[model samples]
Structures are given as C-alpha cells and as structure tokens.
Target: MNIAYLPIDERPCNTDYVRRIADSSAEVKLFLPPQEALGYKKLPADKEMIWKWITDVASEVEAIILSIDMLIYGGLLPSRIHYLRNTEATLWIERLRSLRKEHPGLLIYASNLIMRTPKYSSSDEEPDYYEEWGEHIFLRAYLQNKKQREHLKKDEELQLQNLIDTIPKKYIDDYEERRAFNSTINTSMLKLVKEGTLTFLAIPQDDSSEYGYTSIDQAKVMKGIEALRLHQHVQMYPGADEVGATLLARVYTQLKGKRPRIYPIWSSTLGPQLIPMYEDRPYQESLKAHIFAAGCQLAETATEADIILAYNTPGRVMQESWDQSDKDITYTSFRHLLTFVDQIKQFLNQGKQVIVADCAYANGGDKELITLLDEERLLDRLLSYKGWNTNCNSLGTTLCQGVLGLQGNKQKIIENIIYHIIDDYIYQAEVRMKMVEDFLPLHNLTYFNLKDKVALVNKERNKRVRDAYQLLIRHSFETITRLDVQTFAPWNRMFECGLILKCEQSEVSKKC
Candidate 1:
C-alpha cells in the first residue's frame, strides 16, 4: 500500500508522529510540504498553490491522508495569521471536489476542524470574532433592551445568555446554516467517500464551545457518519501523553492478546502527575496499584525491559512552573532523557528486548534540539517513539485512522473506539481514587470528615486528574495498537530478521 500523508507544514509533532507511523509500514510513502512554508510568519500566499502541489504529488500515490487544516490554515489556530484563514475551509472543499473528479480511484481521507475553546482569561485576546462580537453585543443590548426582559442584571452571565439569544437568527437558529458550513467542507469529502474515491473521513471530536456551538453527542456524530456509509473513527483523548499512552495500551491488548508491562519513566514529577488527571478513578487506581504491586520487578532501572515508556510529561516544566526564572532548569530533564537513551543503547548491545515509547514536547525554538537528537544515535535505538513530529502529536487523529484500518467496518470501528474511550474513563476513576489516597494521608484525614475540603479539592483535582488520565490513557491505547503497527510493521519485520542474524553472530563469537 503506497500511503501518502499531507500534514500541516512545520508542525513538528504531527510530522514526527506520522513519520513514526509511516516508519512502521515499509510500503508507506510520506509526502509532506516543505517545512519552510508552514509557519505563521511564512505561510504560503495562495491556498491553491499548496493544493496544486498536493494534487501534482498525490496523483502517483494509491492512498492519501490529506489534512485539510494543513492545506488551508497551515497549522493550528494559534499559528494562523487571522480568523479569515478559518474561512479557507471553503476553498479546500472546492479543491478536494476537483481532485475527486480527476482521481476517482484514489483513497482520500480528510480531517475536519473541530473547534475547542481555550480556558478563558481576562487578559487574553479573544481569538474568535463571533465570540468577541457575541459578548459585546450581548452586554450592550442586555443592559439597554429592557422591554424584552427584566430582573436580569448586567453581569457576565446575563450578558452571555442575552448574547446567545440575540445571535442573528441566521447564525444561531439556523441549524442548516451551521450544518452547511460544516458540510461545505465535509460534504465534498463525503462525496468522495460515497463514490469510493475516499476510503474514510476522520473528524476529531472537539469541545463544542470552541465553535460557539453546543456540545454534540458522540452517538449523533457517529450516526451521521454511518448514514453516509463511510467509516468514522472518533479521536478520543483526554489531553496528550497520559490519555495517548492508555489508549495505545488498550488497543495493543486487544490486538496483540498479551498485556505488555507499561513502565512509565519520567524525567520530572510532572510526568507522574499526569496519571491522576485524565483517566477515571477505577482504571487509574488499578494501573497504579498494578505498577506498585509489581514493585521493583516491573520498575527496572536498566533499559533491558520489553518496553521503555519514557515521557517528559511536563514538556515545558519551567513554563508550567510557578517561577519563570527556573525555565532553564527544565532543560536538564530533557538532557536526562537523552542520557537514559544512552543507557538503553547499552542494554540493546547486551541483546535485550527494548522499545522506547516517547512522549515529549518540543517548543517552537527547540527544532534544532530535536534535530540534534534525531541526528544522534539516540533516536534510532528505540523500537518506537511518538510526538517526535507534528503528525505523531496528533495521536487522536492517527488512532482513529488506525481503528478504521483494523476494523475495516465504519460502525464497528466507531463502536470499538467508543468502548476504548469508556475504558479510559474507567481508568480515570482509578486515578482519582489514588489521588484521594495520597492526599488523604498528607492531610491526616479520611473520607468521613472531608466534606467541605473534599468539595473544593475535588473541584480543582477533577480537572487535573482528568487531564493526566486522558494523556496517558489515550497515548498508551493508541500508540501500542494503531499508530505503531501501522507505521512500523515492515521495519519491525526487518528488525526481527536482523535480530536473528545478530544472534547467530553472537553464537559464532562464543564458539571462537
């Protein structure tokens, strides 16, 4: 299968992950736009230019994974120059339709943008015009438009509701308008799916608030996709690593039939903290209990283990730290990870099985750091790693695609993906329990007297625990099963052959 991936330019995480996945499949051919053309300051002038480039290159490939966001926006919203860039989705739909006409047999899959609202802050500039205008109009009108309603004060809440009500009926009441906007892009891709020009459409499940829309039901989304008779896989994630890892683990268990011991090695405390944040209480606690129960046996300092799950969870520990001055201190953590890689190499030399499951953040300025690491022998020593490129960081999207490949049926793939998400939720519960256990002892209290404090703590802890659990759960479940195998199948087969040859060489050495 000749697979061509068109990712957003200069997205290191996405590029790295896709590369890892592609590496798994020797038959896969990756087609990424030049990195110099992918950032906010240096994006391509015309969307047509990028699309034309893809059209010219993709004509030769049998299967193509086209990221609409890349061809249109270049990257994520933060990297985009303006809100107008968001409107480029229309152009993409038009171009994709044209492509369908030209290459009807090519398997085309497109990823849609699901907006997610960032945490609100007074100081932060509102990125969306709809959000800013909605807030402004609502506040101004709510205070003056007394004839329509009364008893509502001019606070943020009243203003918000008033704004929601006054949002031009064309924008708010018109579900068709909203659906049309979505379908403008999705419909074109769906056409390809219907005509068997595209194999599937992968849509990332984003928070409703991001699009200034109400929350959508997972079932509803899946049902809509099924009506089209196209395979749909929901990208399930809590955040990044914790969720990513757990999801990969679950998939691996289902596919491989054996649960590999998951050794989570972190360079800092932030990596450890991620576990309780995202996953559900039962699964989180169970995993912790299992790891601790296995004790030293499961936790090997040496890299000779079957799998080396390494993550610098607090990718920017200093950025996350309370003190900005300490940012330099965080660099040590990454260096330490590199040191660990050296140790793993020694173990490989000793003929031990090893797989490095990497989840780390590379900042905007850290491109050279990553390049240097990749150039060093450290990168090749691992059996596999994620988030090394822009594509890989999109664990949710990659996993969803992989699920489609494994199940082959759209509905069943959606069901299994849902089941996997629920499983992560269960694990999240376990993590919450463990947090309670750890915090309770520190407070010298039990659950009996913990009413008021528990309420406050739970409120804050819930978000944290949810995030951590999701990061590990998602990454683990997705990587082990979907991304890794799809990306590395041929490489692994070749590696196994090389391993046999090495063993024979060792036997000869012994005899000599």
Candidate 2:
C-alpha cells in the first residue's frame, strides 16, 4: 500500500514520525515532499512546490494524509502569521476541491490547527511586534472570553477595558483580523467535509487555554461542524502534531477492521487531575480523546486490554525533569519512579504489550526512570514509548505507535520500536534537549529561535550538534539496544532524524 502524507512542518513529530509509525504497522510506502517545502519556526514552506509534487505523484497512492493548514498557509505557524483575504485563501482551499475531482475514490484525511494565543512575551512563534505585546494580547483575549462567558463586576469591567486600552490598537486589530480570517477559512473547510471532499478532518487546538480567543474560536468551529451534521467525520480536540499520528492510526485500524483495547495505568494518584503544559484539559481526558481518535477502545481492566499505557505521573506536582524537584517545583518521588519501572517490568513478564508515557516530569524523560530502566535492561522489552513534547503529545503518540505495533513482521517491529525509543525517548527527552541548552549557544542560538546570521550558523551548529548526538546517542543505544545504528538529523535541526539500522542477527544485512 502507498500513502501520500503531507506533514504540517518538517518537525520530527509531524514528518519522520508518520513514516516510522506507518512502517511498523504494515508494509506500505509513504510519500513526503522534499524537506525544504515544509516550513519550520518562522520559515514558510514552499507551498507551490509541494502542491506540484503532490499533483505529480498523488495518483499512484491509495490514500493521502494532508495538513489542510499546510496546504493553505505552508504550516501551522504560517497559518497564524499569514495575511490573506478570503478570496485569496479560497483560491488555495479550492485546490482540495480540484484534488477530489481528480481522485474520485481516493481516501482523503486532513487536519487543521486552532491558532494558539501564546501567553509568553517572546515572538519566537509569533509576529515580530508580538515580543512587545504578546502577553498583554493573551491576557486581553483571556479576560474578554472569561468576562463574556460568565460576568465581570463593574470594577472588573473597568479593569478589563483599561487593559485593552493599554494595548496598541494596531496590534489588537492585526491579531483580531488574523484570527477572524483563520476561523472563517476553517468553517469553509467544513463545507468540503460535508460534501465528501474530505473523508476525515481533525481540528486540534494548538497550545490551548481555558479562557482565550482560541476557546471562543473553538466554539464557533464546533457550531459549524454540528450544523453540517459532520460530527461523525470531524474531531475537535486540544492538541497538534499528534494529529498526524492519530489519523494514520485511524487509517491503519480501519484498513484492518480491528479496534484494539487500551488500559491506562497511572503511577500517581493525581495523574488525571494534573494538566500538563500547552494543553487546556487534564491528562486523562486527552488520553481518552486520543484513544478514540486513534480508532481504539478503552478497557476498564488491563486484563481485557491489548495495550497498556503506563504513565509516570507526579506524586505531588509535575516538575520539569531539569528542575530535579527543587525550590518548590513539583515532582514525582524516587520511590514512586522505581515502583513504576517495576510495574512495567511486571507487564513485560505478563506477556502484555506495554507503552510507557514517561511524563513523571514534562519536556524530557524522567531521569531516574530511564536510568533504572537501563540498569534493569528493560528498554527493549516495551512495545513503545514517548516523552518529548507536552503531556498530550507524548501520551497520544505513544498510544498510536503501540496500537499499530500489534501487527507487522516481528524483526521489522523490533527495529521500529528501537527507532521510536531512540527518537522519542532518548534524543528528545535527553540528549537533544541538553544539546539545545549547552551546545547551541556556542553558535549563538537557542532552541526557541535562531540568533544573528541564521543561515550559516544553523548549518555549522547543526553539524556540530548532530555529530555530538551521533556519538552520545551511540553510547545511549548501546546500553539499551546494543545496536550501533547510524543516525543523522536530516533537517539539520536535531528535531527530526533519519536512522539506518542494519539487522546483524539476520544472515543478509537487513534494512530496518
């Protein structure tokens, strides 16, 4: 089977992840555009080039998983910053209509992001002037939505107006107009889904909040979906990047006509209550949504489940791993992390497929968990694992990969598992993050954005980091998998990497 996939960006989670997950599940081919055509933090992808690529090759594939946002605005970030009139936006959107007309029977699945109103003062992911007024803009959106949803007292109303008045009218006007355009384009997408132009649509909330302009925009999108009776095909949730994985899992499950059952085991009592970073809801709610989105059922008991989701939730508060539970920061205890490893070991002994969501702390792997798991030689035993981005991203991605690992060639599956372990766990949660903090600065760069002389610096810095990663990752994987797999960051950002694993166990040199 051949599947044409258009990722939101060139990030690991959106691009190679789709390839790795699909490769593990079935013997299928995924066609992706050249890396240059997909956008990055502030770089808009070459949309016209990608459209041409898809047009030329899409006829051969059985299905396509596209990012509707990417098709129209180059990527999720570009979607928010792009200045386009309705007519100009419609010209690009109508390309999908043309696609449907061309491929009448092809299954088309796509996802769009609900623009996030960043709460920070940094313009890393926003427009330039946002660095000055981004936080204020976010507060205004939050207070406005909160005020409209419930009510503000006379004093509170006065405060809200005062806050709005402080923000430059130009900034507020640009932000509002951009959001209104995004919201309008999204609803127009629904009309396509309603007409069967799209087989499935997933609208993931990007960096959502409880009370913000995105929340209000979400309500408007939901109303349109309901009005068209497209709830059966459209899924609105609080997430991004994970959408591609979820949609791919859905396609895999539907093709097999089998819905596996997943049972979640939380190491901490407050697991469900704690809301991880960049999300609006608690962990359990997002897990359930992701499970359903992946075409899987939730089992009440582990005994009835085909896969087990083991989360390293915090005991008191979820602290960043780098913080080491210091200075009032929340963290899971050493004893609890040890106990959690024992639980996963028990599952492996019980002959059950276990996928570890190692979010004992967010943004990286639980150091103690990885250390102890390595000492016990249990990393290779698990079905899958994830702990890189927000809690929602880690949990959903691990679930999707685990669900897909249920089938496929055994040796091939093992290779795929090792790949995921390397990328999602070791590289993301451990090495790459440290490199971002320590190594990148030598070239005057930070993880969030590039400093002066981006083009030349990015190239030299990526080489330096990638070379160091190849060395460090070699040692890490040796302790776990005992395989010296060749790894390279194709995009030169250390965010997404390509691995060429050779099967030494087989008589022929096997490519995995």
For this target, which candidate reaches the highest lDDT against the unseen true structure? 2
Q: lDDT for model 2, on a 0 to 1 scale?
A: 0.75
Off by over 4 Å in 2: 152-159, 325-330, 333-335, 409-512
Estimated TM-score for each candidate: 0.43, 0.86
For candidate 1, what is the TM-score? 0.43
> Candidate 1: where are CA atoms >4 Å away?
16-28, 35-45, 72-75, 78-94, 121-184, 206-214, 217-220, 229-381, 385-512
Residues 1-512 of candidate 2 have per-residue lDDT tens digits of 67788988777668767777777765567788998788665678888998998888779987788898888888877887888788878787788899999999888888888888989887766888889989889988888998889987898788789878899999889999999998988898899899999888888998899898889999999999889998778888888878888888777777668899999888777777778767788888887888888889999998999998888776666666455426123354422666777888888899999888877665656656666776676765777767766777777678777877776555555565566555555555556656677767777766654445455544444454345434433222332223555555544454544555454335343222
How many clashing residue pairs, candidate 2?
Answer: 0
lDDT per model, in order? 0.39, 0.75
Model 2 is weakest, by summed lDDT over 10 consecutive residues, at: 473-482
Candidate 1 — worst ten consecutive residues by lDDT sum?
494-503
Model 2 pairs whose backbones collide: none
lDDT of 1 at 254: 33
